[model samples]
Target: MALTPDEIDGLRELILAVYGPVTEELLRDLCRCITAAGQISSGDEYKLLLAKSLAGADDVIADTLRRQTDLTDDAVEQLMRWAAEKTAPLEENESLRNIAEAYVKVTRKEVANVLGQLAAADVDGRVYPIKDVYRRTMDYVFREVSSGTKTPEEAVRRATLRLWQRGIRTVDRSDGRTFSVEFMAQRAIMAKMGEMTTAINEKHHDDGGCDGWEISAHSASAPDHEPYQGRQYSDKEYKRLNSRLQRRIGTLSCKHIAWPIKLGVDSPQWTNEQLAEMARENAKGVTYEGRHYTQYEATQQQKALENSIRQCKDRIAAAQEEGKLGSGELRSSRILLRQLNAEYKRFSAAAGLRTAPERLRAAGLGRALRPDGTLEMPRPAGTLTGSGGKLDVEEARKSYSAYLDTLTDAPEKNMVWLRYFTEKNPTEYMEDGTLDAPFAYDPVEDRILYNPRHPQFSTTDFEMANTHELAHRTDVLNAQGYKNKAFVDAISDASKAVLDNAEGFQRVAQAVRSDLMKDILSALSSGRLDTGFGHKAEYWAKNSEAVPLEIFAELFTMETRNDSDLFFVKKLFPGLWKEYQKLF
Candidate 1:
């Protein structure tokens, strides 16, 4: 289990507290010395005073580091216990408990060694001795105050804010990257816990003599892991699967858990249908602020907001301790904190996600909220104009007739079919008066019906719809029925090509203006094209038999719209578009 937000906030507060009072006092004393001396100097008296001000900072930092290490150990132990209990049913002996104790012992030693080396924190990847940080901070404050760049109070406030914002950098990587002490600690603890849990589960499987393990499933699983979720695999198969993945199962940051199970004896946790439904639900994510966000994306957004709010609180606390409560920086930070909190709540509610208030908690700070003490609920995005409005049957007929009149240059055979169908089937309202099934063609009755008030019609112009229907009519007439082998083969070939060259197809999808095209392309890019086609393809392609026909009609409409769209269709499916061109 990941450390809850409250735990993380606690660690953050510890790190901030390390520098808050000490840094502020150092700045104040340095400014006073500079004021008396009229300028900062390297003389022995100045050096002596500076050394005296920073004398106990190292002890304070070391003590805080020890406390942070202890807290981290506690959090890791708790997480281990949680994992052990979760897998307790499968445990045959005290081995899991032994594993937990050993892991915690080893982890505590390792973390302590790492934190011990950090006698001074690094800022922006630059390690500084405690004396150097004080010297640099003092120099900066002196320069700003003496140069008229800032008043003494402003300079001290800025310096203190910077130190608090940077936090204590405890981990430096070979890649020349550095992370705050708490961040690295949390990451290491969680990673070790994951590894320990994986080892324990493997031991259980070995002890139970299970043939394989079943990977757990969850909504919005990482893209690469989604395919393997809820499925059981033999030992060899599981190893081979991991060999192909950049991120193996049960690795750090992966929430999936595996348990031992006899292949034939233990029932699968999820059926195929259930897994498929989970994938579909994940694909159909909620829209917030006019942009679609998958469940994973939504959670990430929430985390980001939480981080921002925490930072704001830390800054505000630092300012208050510095006695700059009325400073502009503090005022802006408080205002931003409120906005961030409101947004976090609204976004979670809109996305149908639960808000983790513990994650929003900031150590040593009260709740930050608007004056009304209530967060505003999010409203649904505005509805499209004319959506589900009344349909003027005669006007729709006239519109289609006028559209057909412009296609006189079309092939005689196609024209005859279109004109005949237009006369035989006058446009009429759907029985429900809404376009629940807008712009449909019934080949059995040789009928064409439309719902002009459909929301989709708000963006899709009439010419595109008419051309699409005409294309469908021509396909039926030429093939003598909807079961056209050549048509299906062409669409199948194009679809395969699209899948094979998904990146290129996405580029083409980007160039197209049609929302339908964008949706189809997005699905293709995400390996969900078939899923999209089955569920919410085009309005015309609702069933298996109709997919190819609807795709062809869609491409036909795209080609007829403008030269740009025609080029896109050609780029998307060169062979299919070429073959379709002969129809014109």
Candidate 2:
């Protein structure tokens, strides 16, 4: 087979263009996978094995993973043991890498969040969680394919052509009593023994392992082994082709702290006080209304309002100051103060008071204090207001199950079990999306916010909205105890250090951005195209290698198409690539 180095570069560069630069570890892992493209047991080869192994029994995969990824030889042996037990996770990240494990956690959270959000996003609306099977299979393929052969286009052509050209066939070496190739190709490179063994589903008569599976050496093929497809894969041909492509996509996605967090300044020449004073000075030029307030009337109105409020408070004080005033006088002063307080409160809250009576009396009095500089104003408190009731378990389950029917291979998926595992999680706050996470926010409220809103292509809001929350979950709130402290601050500090170095540009967030974009692109490509995807495809391509990866976050962000889309499982991430645009 023929392939080229430039194609590998193009594919890698294109991956960056579409997905973004992968993380250091993932990049390293991909490098290892790609470099070992022609070599046996490369990344992609393992992935195929793992995929085939996991396609049937998930428990086996889980058990193997549980024993592996422990950073010890014993763990490796245990993993080997379990794989032999149920066939096994054949990929590097599958129960093999800690980051991969972490990734599963993050993605699982996304799945769970979609379910939770879907249940809560709508009250009386029909929703469908969109899914695409071909895209998923493509993901598995691309993730393990190696581009290190330096002949990607050629290799792709050859691999695609091989299926039709000479075709594949299996034979028996009656002497060795093993399954061998009936015909040999000009350059049939042997990549692995088991890859051929597994690919052909060749059961070794002498092989020993759990059930009817083969584990050890590929000594011979079983006599009862049936023919594969129209023919059998030559051990040499099978390994060569499988390993070639396997290594091609055996790319490991590395994750790192976002560039903004990494690029954080530790010791600037200007101190915090200096920064604050500068902010105050900057604030001086603008009036409260967010416009200019240089001349008389504008400033005068503010002054008058202050004076009026102060005068009201003074009246209240006076009633107490002089004992000559009756209870009626005190009542009148309190009412006057309240009216001034009401005016201020009205300005603060566009909505009328929803405050409890006890809070009203105290907060109302505090508002009166804002008039006089001497009187202390109470600090405004933020509330996590949300509207939703307990989920009708039956309805939610029915909707989710119905949505599952849209998928191609539902029975093989164990994710439904997870649905039974997690009931709906309550959303106590909205601030989590905007203010709660670390790094700079892209909110319209802040002038320094990186990007303004990019409208989604779909008329609905649920898909992206669902994905957006899940991204937040993965990015910031994945682990426990993050809510308890300023963890983002410390992480930001460290990430800032990483970003200061040139290597920081190749952080994990960048890779995730790339991975997601590629997945989205693949999802949109083979499956039904949404037709209305704007320049989002270009946006992802541009940010594929963006430095300071925080700038590329838009690549993975999603929003709901509508309230129903929020709660619907079918639409969770369903082929919505347009929403990723503008992060570049």
Q: What lDDT would candidate 2 get against the real structure? A: 0.26
Q: What TM-score against the true fold does each predicted structure earn?
A: 0.52, 0.17
Local distance difference test, each candidate: 0.55, 0.26
Residue-level lDDT tens digits of model 2 in 323-348: 23223444575666567655555433
Candidate 1 lDDT over 401-470, as tens digits, reads: 4344333224455556555656564433342344364566666655555654556554454544556677
Span of ten consecutive residues with least summed lDDT in model 1? 374-383
Candidate 1 Cα errors over 4 Å, as ranges: 1-46, 89-92, 117-131, 147-149, 157-164, 173-176, 358-584
Runs in model 2 with CA error above 4 Å? 1-486, 507-584
Candidate 2 TM-score over all chains jointly? 0.17
